[model samples]
Target: MNYFIFGGSGFIGTHLINYLKENKAGSKIYNLDIIENTHNGKSIFINCDVKSEINLNIPVSENDIIFNFAAIHVTPGHPDYDYFETNIKGAENITAFAEKFNVKKILFTSSIAPYGASEEMKMETTTPMPNTPYGISKLVAEKTHMIWQAKKNQQRQLTILRPGVVFGKGENGNFTRLYWSIKRHRFFYPGRKDTIKASIYVKELVRFMVFRIENKNIDIEIFNCTYEPAFTIEEISNSMMEITGMQRKIYKIPAGILKIAAGIIGAFGGKSIGIHPDRVKKLMISTNVSGKKMKTSGYNFHYTFDQALDDWFKDNNKEYLS
Candidate 1:
């Protein structure tokens, strides 16, 4: 019942650590990451980089579960090589640790980017058509873990969750940025408002992971983890506006104009204006990945777009918004 979470300092990992501790799960939880996760005081912390050549120093048992959430995930943030180096190597090292330490299961939180930017509904069975370096690296990382699982005759369970834009209290990504924009009455619907942006609440994602782990089967299971019906940009913006009681004017900026603006701003290389060409391009595409597997597994998502926003606003106030 023990848990070892790699990349525990990041948003999703931080939430998972707190969830495990709050539930009073009667087992020690070890965190391995490049930086110390100070959010949870009870969990044991081990400063270890997954990309480093050195193996992790934490003790592991056959009953222990290793969750690999470590990766260079920010699409516009890292160089192409950095993505491959960190994600692929991180996977290799983590799986190697599992093999060496005889850990019973490895749960990896991969991104929906592996399926590439698609307007169509992408299921777990869909062939991965990764276009970006980050996408390709994640796909390779999945393969690397699968190879390790095969070494154990597929007896050691592997659960890979491909989550999309997971958001909650500490999130600083798209959701957080959008939240502030709406709060300030400055948010706009870029390009088409109908484009679906798949996402999950961080708490729900963590809960689903725990549910899967507790009822784990020996065979490998890959689930596309997000809310049942992915929210469109309009839906998200409307929810934000309604929840915050701010009826901000929704500007309809053209996609090409946004791209050019992002390009010009990104070229300067000064302090980030929070808009990059990659991020702009991402906004135009539909990340409508399907969560059929998780839904079919009989797990009910507790939050919709509006409910999640309400919970976030209630639980986290000025700090997260500002």
Candidate 2:
């Protein structure tokens, strides 16, 4: 099988490459990213922006699977316009080219951001009230894929995946952030450590995506691709402690106080505030996502938040720590 993927150098993309190499052997995977090479063997890196490569000049065929996993994601301070152009325009070009190239399946990695800041576990069917331009752009990107797929009809299939905060070995995502902070003893849970923050490990996410690719016969395909049971920041913190034998005092300040503090920061630096005031607000709130669709679609999560954190780090030689 020929699989063409965009953004294989970063967190999610790299994990997907690992999956393809380890599990999808004998398959040729083309990784398209703007940066220079980040992987080795059986894969070729295309040092071109996803938007630029949308010309369908690359070797995409009707038999190939195209995955769009590229985006300009910078939380807490990314400009709204850059977020829109990269996330929205990137999606537009990818989907358009997928149509033109007659790609068999297009898998788009979106975010739980589209579901807004939630106080409960969100389902795939839940109504989305995107809190930030990033969230709005992600939702728009997912729609663009659908629109293109409909136009191309049977020739193309589109699968949209909304994974919770994705974590992996050496990831800058929530898990590693908490780990590093805990290692430094600066990690604190502002509201409550027990707030159910939705997350999935990178390996598990790639596993689910691979599961989908191998078994596309299933219908009802949109998935909230996180670990089945959600993990609270407290649970995650505790898990980290178990893994690293690390411990730190966790402080819980009132959410109101944090809001006031953020307001002060916003006054001093508007752009420094984040995509929205509630970016942190959303994280503090419970936003667990169930992987019911992924499970029913023959995909299963390989790690609990605890297991995913503990087991992978044993390979200390790996560069995920960097």
Which prediction has the highest lDDT against the true structure? 1
Candidate 1's displacement at residue 40, Å, is 4.0
lDDT of 1 by residue, 1-322 (tens): 6889999888888888988998856888888888987974757888888887646555668899888999998867788999999999999999888888788798998889889887989999999999999999999999999998888855789999999888888788888878776666545556788989988888899999888887758878899988777889888888777876676778888878877877887789621746677777777889998877788898877777678778877776623442
Angstrom error of the Cα, residue 90, model 1: value is: 0.9
Ten residues in sequence with the least summed lDDT for candidate 1? 313-322
Q: Estimate the lDDT of model 1.
A: 0.83
Predictions: Cα RMSD each: 1.9, 3.2
Off by over 4 Å in 2: 56-58, 218-220, 258-280, 317-322
Each prediction's Cα lDDT score? 0.83, 0.74
What is candidate 2's TM-score against the reference? Answer: 0.88
